[model samples]
Target chain A: MSFLRTAPAFRAGLGMRTIHTSRVAAVQASKQVRAIAADETAGFKYTAENAILKGTVNDAVAVPTPNKAHGSYHWAFERLVSAAIIPATVAAAVASPTAHPIMDGVLGVTILIHSHIGFSACIDDYVDERKFGALGTACRWLLRVGTAGALVGIYEFNTNDIGLTELCEKVWKA
Target chain B: MARRFVQTNSISEMEGLKLLNTQRMNRPVSPHLDIYQPQVTWVLSGLHRITGVAVAGVFYVGALTYLLHPIYPAIDSAHLIEAVHNLPVWFKTSAKVAFALPLTFHSFNGIRHLMWDTGKGLTMKGVYASGYAVMAASVISTIYLAFFV
Candidate 1:
């Protein structure tokens, strides 16, 4: 009879040992889960703070200097190319009529005359720079163009019914 | 230690101007006219091209009139009359009107060119405004010649 009572106590002790072991494992797992969650939360908070700080610093530091510099350079470059290059090209085209080889003699002569005159004017400009100084440099090109223009005027006057031939004859004392 | 610095500066622009003026007291005073550079109309240039094309068109009209004149001599012989004629007053008047188109265009366009030669019509606003003026003048002249002979 004492042995039978000892058997029940021993079984109860075995059960208690199993339950304690399971409880210990469960506590360890819960602590590990808590640690993982804490770590994730800390990582998220750190990343968000870093992003906000970086964005604020970028706005404060780079906004004014970079923005205006980029804007003015872009606008000025665009305007310069449009205003200068395009008209210069058009003027060059006007001065050169050999682009149309099949033009009539009258038209061809007109074009050739203008183009040669233009080239001469360009040369005159270079010479003027050496001889006349900077003040005359500005007017030099104008003077050449004006001379060519005056010739064109004379041509028109000659062609018209204004008796320019008579006037010329008188001026020449012929 | 003691340091000494010389206090000498070059003359200012105003002082220089005063000195120059004092040196030239009896110089003749003439207002500078050419110093004021005039404005230019840029758009008139493009219009000048257009009017040149119009002048070519007028030439073609004259050519066509010459070609068609003999077929309809009663209608209008002015276009076909290569030589001078002793015609009725109305026919003479019509002939004058017909001849005036190309001449008038040439004259007006020449004036526009003269304006350009003087360095006028170089700006955007000036260009467009001058273009408008050219059109107005061309139209008025065309109408006057076409109707009034």
Candidate 2:
């Protein structure tokens, strides 16, 4: 084992019995150890920083900021509106004969918004703009037009006809 | 070390998509719906999307029918109501119950989803608890809406 350790020194023409050569070998070994430790610490920091910067750059280059923000807020708001509709609907259903126009109007708007968001999300998931560019655009426009017409129809029903909840109740008894 | 850096500026969106597609093609597809065990999370997620479409469809169809009421008097609200009213009692109850069930289930499960969005009820225990809670709420609400309301 010792001969193996000394082989490189002997090949480099450093005599093993010389005190100066041994001291020089010890100094080189310590320097190499220090260099390795320094490299490890530096490598760790570089890798961590590189990972973070790469992630940021990729997001900025690949995804539009508005699209990213669109998803979370849209999802949360849709859920919020749907949650609010529950109590309003139950109350509206129970108070059938006496129609509350305001409550009914609120229900109409919330349902429109909720359904529009849901439909839009489905379209976003299923339709790839890169693959079906024109179809995707058309579907989105169709949704907008359909939502507007539905909103108007709902408004008319709530006002001219018996409101939604009442109509459901009436249908139930029918 | 210098050779490790990749120049991404020359890469077009189409090229990137092609690369991704190639990689996807090479990998064995895993966790496919047909092969994977059906779990609560995915089941609920699928149901959420389905219910969303169903509810929107109901609204769209209703609105379209109303718009066409001029041509078809039978589709008018009064006539439609009367038509439903004339149905047998069992049919009426069953139809209303079926209609109410989806609406109530979607509404209750939706609230649970909203809770998840807020980062609550995400643990396994929380998920199961919320799932059972949503089921109970839907049943109770459906019964009330169909019968009492």
Candidate 3:
């Protein structure tokens, strides 16, 4: 207890010594400052209160305002379509060889949309304009073209041959 | 004992600014992946992304293969089915189950996400409940599709 009590006093003495020396050093340093040129101080004004430049330039001019509502709406619709396709897929699979054309068509469209949304989400994550400018643009265009081709291929398969679900069923049985 | 004091000069404004920027650069970032406890919400969300990519990949591959039917007769659905038929029993069953499981999980979890979008099932309890339900449904659906369907 006695040691603890004296420790702070010892620290205080050391601190006082350092402060006294720093004050003397500061006095000597101040004498070393070069005289300011007349032109350097010509337009300088001293004020008690600091002035902050306000509205000197617009910082948000290039920033794009995002549409939150559209984003959420699209997200919700993608989920809805995904959920809806489950039953459609199961029904088509079970009905197999004689599944109705309407069911096949619905499945094709829903699957295409779901895949497109999913692939776009991936592209958004890994291929952002902020990161990979020209490559991102190229990837976005490629996705668009791939989606179109997929839709056409699905349509052709459904119309000209046995539908997708039927083909899966055949594969499973095989 | 006399303490010897070594004097140092003040840093210039630009040098001070550079030092501050370097300090900022060296500071550790927060919310690192290792710091967070893995939870159902993010785990399921990640799985949803993975399954989404898997499903899309399969669809694209299938469509592309189908498009090449003229160039390669073996790429046709009948020929593909024949190839699968030649595989052993275990391989066939496992392949079907593997195919169906991800699709089932993704579909059910997607419904849960839609419910969240509608501002439902977002509480911790609700998230866990729905996550378990999706897993259960995926297992059941995969079984039925692989064995019965």
Candidate 4:
């Protein structure tokens, strides 16, 4: 058997002497998907962070592949959307529809995004793919489709109707 | 010779693991949410999310309902206003309170969250102070909006 030269994994060009042992069951790592254990799920294995209480020390850590979009950028985006809601809400409270028709549409979209992100966070926490399987996938897709439909609905309300700001104002008084 | 009163069973590695897993299935999860006494810190945190979901849920449902405008002509804003207007005075006031409470609480608590994001007001003392502050502010704001505004 050849030892890996200064690497955790065997490099592609490294030549290794073949070693066969009946004691150690051997299987190749999957090319398309990675699973921690032989019968484990592709994503995170632990149902909850607190599952460590019952877990073995040998359980593999679920290290996420960091992406710019889903990392710090997502946090920044969420904060930005939240901050944007402040002004949009103010405009909704005080602005006149006839004077600024687009303001209604702006508020609708901003609030929609903020709501979507909040719901998405809940779904991610509770309906994890590793735990909930098909149900989890369904919730995520439903959120997406619902968001799209809501966007269209908001657009229609803003364009054709008395607009959301005026509608809220009227409703509050009503 | 002392009498032995111990018994043991030899198990393969896989069998041992299976036994372990079976036992693990019945392991009680400690420090459950129900056992915790209600306090300002966690209570406010819970309320923040709950109120946020309540307010946002309404927003989403409203926006989604607008999609039905094409099919249901009576489902417009005018009809909604008329429907609410036709309700009794007590019902109207209570409805206003219902809407105002969650809206104000979520809004005020959200600012608290934003302050936290900027790495401010996160101390134990600061957290409590802010929690009380949010509660007061949200209550007053909701009352003002529901009763006066």
Using DockQ as the yardstick, the better of models 1 and 4 is 4
Candidate No. with top TM-score: 4
Cα deviation at A123, candidate 1, in Å, is 22
Instruction: Give the per-residue lDDT of model 2 (tens digit) for A73-172.
Output: 7666666787887887766656543447778777777888888888988888776453356787899999999988888788777776776767765676
For A1-174, candidate 1 gives per-residue lDDT tens digits of 899979868988778534568788888877522112111221122221122111111124223456654577754543343234234434433543233222222332343243333334444544444444564566666555544554444344334312222331232221
TM-score of 1: 0.24
* CAPRI category for model 2: incorrect
Model 3 alpha-carbon drift over 4 Å, by segment: A1-63, A66-73, A90-99, B1-35
lDDT over C-alpha atoms for residue A134 of model 2: 73
Per candidate, the number of residue pairs that clash is 9, 2, 0, 0
iRMSD (1 decimal) for each model: 25.7, 10.7, 10.7, 4.8
Please provide, for model 4 over A1-174, each residue's C-alpha lDDT reduced to its tens digit, 9 standing for 90 to 100.
356554535543375635556434444432334222444322224444323222233455566898989999999999999989899888876878757889878888998999999999999888977667778899999999999999998888888888888887888889
Candidate that beats the other on TM-score, 1 or 3, i.e. the better one: 3
lDDT of each: 0.43, 0.70, 0.73, 0.80
TM-score of chain B of each: 0.37, 0.73, 0.79, 0.92
TM-score sort, best first = 4, 3, 2, 1
The most accurate candidate by lDDT is 4
Tell me which residue pairs clash in candidate 4: none
Sort by DockQ, best first: what order? Answer: 4, 2, 3, 1
Provide DockQ values for all models, in the order shown. Answer: 0.01, 0.22, 0.18, 0.29
**What are the per-model C-alpha RMSD values against the true structure?**
32.1, 13.3, 13.1, 9.8
Q: lDDT score, residue A50, model 2?
A: 24
